[model samples]
Target chain A: MTAVSKLLRRSETAVLAILIVVMLVIGVINPAFWQADNLFNLLRANVVIGIMALSVLTVMISGGIDVSFPAFAVAAMYLTVIAMNAAGYQGVVLPFIGATLIGLLCGLANAFFIHTFRMIPLIVTLGSASVVRGLLLGLVGTSIINIDRMPPSLIAFGSSTVDIGGSKLSLMIFIYLGIAVLMWLFLTRTMAGRAVFAYGDDAESAKRVGFNTRRTVYLVYGLAGALAGFAGLLHSSMIWLANPRDFVGYELDVIAAVVLGGASIFGGRGSVFGTILGVFMLTLIKNSLIIMRIDNTWQGVVVGCVIVIATALTAWRDRKALV
Target chain B: MNKLTDFRRFVNRDNNIVQLLVITAIIFLLMSALEPHKFLRYYNFESISFIFPELGIVAIAMMLAMLTGGIDLSVIGIANLAGILAGVFFTRLYPAGPDAGAAAELMRVAAGVVLALGVGLLAGTLNGLLIAKVKITPILATLGTGQIFTGFCMVLTGGPAIVGFPAWWGFIGNGKILGVAVPLILFLVVAVLIAVMLTKTPFGLNLFLIGTNPRAAVFAGLRTERMVLYSYMLSGTLAALAGIVLSGRTNAAKSDYGTSYLLQAVLISVLGGTNPAGGKGTVLGVSIAVIALMLLASGFQMMRFSNHLIDFIWGGFLLLVMVINVLRNRGR
Candidate 1:
């Protein structure tokens, strides 16, 4: 690292370091924390959040907060499962595919508003988020859908684990890491991808420079919605049940992850590396808390504190950057 | 083509009104077509007018704060806290015969009003202090306070609702005065008082000017801070009063009583043509919009749809109205 970079360690680096230290402390206090089964379960638990955080990072970087992503995911998941079940197609792939496309469709609608209406992203997504969540609740009508038929492929997709030297690794971890790499490549290696970064930096300046900043904004939000959908698919497959109330506060966690990763909510500037580190940082804190056998209720308090501290620091940095 | 262009501008100029009318029409048609007898009743229409006043009062409070280029998310929380205080005192103030007939019960209600208003004013002043002195962004700072204050309410009530408030206080909520609910009449009085302050007084003028551009207002020698501070304090007091009304209407206090009002009140203000970025909008417009929303919702419920359906439609309608507004605004 450069000398200057050393003094001001990037948020991702700081987050990851904290995660590792916390992990080590947990392992020391309770060996069960580092145990193969428990760690795998923990990773499994964060799969949806980790994937959704990637989506949030994209939208936030593009100067919009797509709060509807989670609700859209719920819509996708419910519609897919209910439709396929009614069709007597007991296969999970059909539902997964259905949900993903529906997510993209919702994203497209969001994009249209962002580009056409110029409605503030927060307002648009939040409004639609409620609508979508409402529809999801309407569809299920207080009933849980249990997927027990012909879904070996889907279950295997989420259930598969790699045994690495007596330590088990979840398919979720691989899925999360895979998306991180794809995001990294898309962000760093492609023209449209880099344009996403530019638009996020400043829409006014970016528009002046002849970038189709408006269109790019739509695509970024669309992609975020799609990712949230994909994550929802993974969520349902792993749980083997579709409940409307599942992931009620999913958007909050995703935003928290992105902010903790050092992304600005006012838009422009984020790193895939930072987000990945954020995912692990929260995962670590949660897993460690469990390992310590502390009251689960304290989890909210701890997470809340970390989130405030992280966002405050990021905002402080943004203010400093302006200077 | 000429007709089409005119139609678009009409929709654009009065987007919120158009949305409200459209929603009302939809509900009317649905009721007539799907559930006629219940929907066409005049009682339901009257109910909408009555229920609307409480929301109207809150909207006025929200508009005053928004007019000063800030927000008061804590108002709903303050309302909830006030409601709980009212509930606690009602239960404890009288072990009377068949009602809270204890003269002490009246004192308790009075005490509840004052305490609630004090709590709300303190919260709003704290918000103003942070915004004026610490220079925190209004959105973020209010969001944080919203959480802290709401969290405190949840803690105070242990996340459950309070019920069994005094009967006399409940009567204040349910009683009619001169052919209108007493609370509704009270709301009208509050609205008129505020309308006078917002349009006729220096405080109101300063508020509008400050919202348009605080720096310019400051340069122009207005005490921008005082205007903002006063606006928030007024917002808090009004919200607290509304809380008392809401509790009396419901005959109980719940932690979640005003939780949903946060979004709904803001939506009404914005829908009433109040700019979120502030400077433009009137109490008259907002009051009308609030009445329209209540009518629309009650009209639908009267037509036999569930509350969930209304909520779904409400969220969608708000989105549609807000999007149209944004499309019209030439953002700088």
Candidate 2:
């Protein structure tokens, strides 16, 4: 492959490097870190965050950051759970659909302020983020409303695992893999995918070349919103409860993984595979801390260091790109 | 009506300061209406003025960084970290201390402040190196660093609050110079110094230029990296100062200490009309915004409002200002 093409592929390489290092380090520190049970648990716990990170990657690549992501997701989770409980609905699919729609609505609101009003994307999203979170808190009365009537199948959404020769993978892994493949196709194969990249790379230039800049920005944000919503549904289904407070705080971690995965905040770059690798690296590191019994306080320190180093490396790549 | 229109125009251009005064006046009026006996107490006014100085100090430092075309999301993090470190060093959290003798205590405080400033410098330099040298986007880099610093603080404290500072430094927090609180006086000195820096120093000039036009700043042969680095360092150090005061007042520090301040700082910064996308804003404007926010909080308290509701009100105001800015910019 040409050198230019090779440079374009480095995002995935960096994520892979991070994944390998942490995996080996964890394995060395505690042999059980690589054990099947623990790895599957790690995968299960990170399902919601990992999915959100993938969504953030899309918008960041398309030239905008979705600060409203966590808010949207949490809001969706809150609404779905509350609506289902209030309605006494029994169907799993209907509740999940309701959640997805809530997320989409939040995303569309962000896009409206961003595009139609010509507001700065960051400012608008930041505002909407707070508003959405407040709305959720107001709606949920700032309490954890547990879903006691959760069906057996619903409970299994987060718990069910398939055992393959005593080495099992959690259902979360499949969900992540499925979503990653779909996003990969969406970003690489279609006119919309090209638009996401072009808008992020240079929106004005994209507009000059006759691309629909406004629509592209809106769609990217909308897609980001929908995915965040979907993640909320998965989270509630997995955990058998919808929560708001913890999820918004987790957005920082998701953004960190995306950036560490080699997505440029400047937009027009990054991919799903890199992000998946980043999620795996973070999840492994966190779970390994639990296994090593090293106070788990060091989890933040380790993750922080990894982010700094990875970003530094990516910065190095960016310099080379500019040159 | 013509005169009023001109006056309104002036207020619009300088609305943050105007907004603060108007809100404070409105609050006092409301307080009197609710219960003239308690709300108009001299002590309450003293307390409000007393708390605002440190906030104003941090605001100026933050404004400097923002003026230089970057946001210092790490400010609150640094402040919380420094406060905890200061508390630990002062009270001897570990090593159980020689009880940190007065001289040692003083030394630790200074060192704590310096390290906080040093951390700021290092972070700012890293930010500069990336934006100037590595070509990473400032927003994402700062955002990452903000969390990392916050995570470091959380890790150090095990996600808990660290306590045990001598009440003596409450003197620092509650101290007054000729009837004005020490913090307020310090704030004034800081404000004047910042005003001079922005207008008098080449570094300041570089900041203004960079914010307005990076290409032009580069063309002017200004060391843009140095200017940006200096801005970040100042922001970090100022945030650390705020942390010190917070620790002094509360006699404790925690990991989650300044998470709330993240919104507070940004709210004031944005409310003061400092363009979030970069290049435009003033220290006076941010200071006014801080005062406005403080007043709003006090008003909420007077009205028997919960902290959560206060936050809701603050968020609502932020949204309103953003919408207005969008509409005005759209017209342009």
Candidate 3:
């Protein structure tokens, strides 16, 4: 009984409850929402954003925020595609690896400036976001790569699916689940992961306790960048087009997801489970609006209201606890 | 000898203003040297005068928010919403065929301006309440509100530009007063007023104190929450003023117009030496930085550089300024 009550007290449980409630409400509004194909489509649509949210969760856990990952993601995706087309490379693994590496480099640039100058993470990432995006659009090419120009292997990979009870499921969902599980393990059962929590909770104390704060910072941002990069490529593949200007205003959405998942913007709190739930909640609300027959114009207002109300509630709860 | 020393001390007191002046001078000289025929033309400078004020005002608004250890990402959204609403008002009550007397037209435009500013005031109040009373982090609160504002704009206009503003409205953006661009004059007046407010007002001093140390300010018996709320309100009004100028200049208002200005505003604020971490900035410094960037942008355009490259340079400039500030602090 105690264990069950404790579970209910956890923030993840609240997020889960909310998610279920929203799903049920939407399902009732539009019976088509409960269809297996629609469900699978929703899950598939969440793959890229889910992966990026996990990255954001990591950074927030380390007491920092990154608005540059979307820029990094698009840069990696566009540059990787451009490079592959130029070199006549046709494989998927090499492009993914190259994109991830590029993302890691951008992340490190952020980590370097932040660590060396002791600058605020927000400002550093903001600057880097601008630089990466400007370079991608300016130095490289600004045109979108259509299906004819996109590598065949990537499109094939994107289109590949598994039949589950006569329903087609994109193979990308499994990768997202795999990454989420790995992240959960890394954040829960590892010494390095604990170090991240400690640093976020109290940086000065963590340093005094001989934790390698520098390594923690790098690990957090580097992993975020790499995931963002991988997600970017995956997004292009799934969509079957590579647009340089993709993900222009996606940072807020991803950040909103993570925060809604019960992550503290002030740091030292968050979970992979809660974050995934948050992503689903957001994705469902966004995708189901059309099914529910709501005017598409009201989408932004609805999402914005949800974000503000949810964050305000969480903040209020935290304040009450302090008092 | 005494007056000279006093002047030196004044200059040395805030090195950022002097540094901004020097940078502006260098940019001006370099642009002139590179493209004398194009850059030094009368029309080029005139166009810049008309263009920089909207961005300049928004940057100042950003600086005000930063002063209180917060940021108002909703500035651009507020600008657009204000402009769009004003456009809606004008379209609804526009005198057909100039049948109405000139007095009525003037009244309509004046009412439109008030309505636009009122929208800003209300939006800012919401932002302030969210940040102050609700205790949500400033960034997240503003981000959500920005979306709401933009979404409201879309619902109002149904995803198209609202055009057909009054002819007199254009004068605010494009007219000249005593050989000075109207927008330029407005920007200068706003800058001077803000400089005085920051330096002379009790509210301004309280903002710096609160940003520098919230706990201390609270203990010192300051109404930190109210001060923050007021600052955001002022920021919103300034943004609305920018929006008015923007709509007047373009003779239209759209949901996505000046989307890029958000980035430019942040860049200009930081370039002006406003510490993002809060408690430090100067109106004079920000004004000079905006002009310097305007000059650089114009020069780049003259040289046929893509707008993207200019954006890239602005980002690089932000990072470079960060490094310089750090090194200088270390030396001190």
Best by TM-score: 3
Q: How high is the lDDT of residue B137 in model 1?
A: 48
Which has the greatest DockQ?
A: 3
After superposing candidate 3, which stretches have Cα over 4 Å from the reference? Answer: A320-323, B93-98
Query: TM-score rank, highest first?
Result: 3, 2, 1
lDDT of 2 by residue, B208-268 (tens): 8888887777887888877777777777777777777777666678877757677667777
TM-score per candidate, in order? 0.83, 0.90, 0.98
Instruction: Give the winner by DockQ: 1 or 3.
Output: 3
Query: 2 or 3, which is superior by lDDT?
Result: 3
lDDT of 1 by residue, A1-323 (tens): 89888846777677777778878888888988767778777777677888889898988888767768878887777677667667767565667667878888888888887788777676677677777776667545647777664244566666777887787677677878898899889888988788888888888888899888767976797788788788887887777787766776566567777777878876778888888778767777766776798755455446645665676566666665431
Candidate of highest lDDT = 3
**lDDT, each prediction:** 0.74, 0.74, 0.91
Model 2 segments more than 4 A misplaced: A1-9, A147-153, A320-323, B1-40, B93-133, B329-332
Question: What is the TM-score of chain A, computed separately for every candidate?
Answer: 0.92, 0.92, 0.98
Q: Is candidate 1 or candidate 3 better by lDDT?
A: 3
Q: Model 2 lDDT vs. the true structure? A: 0.74
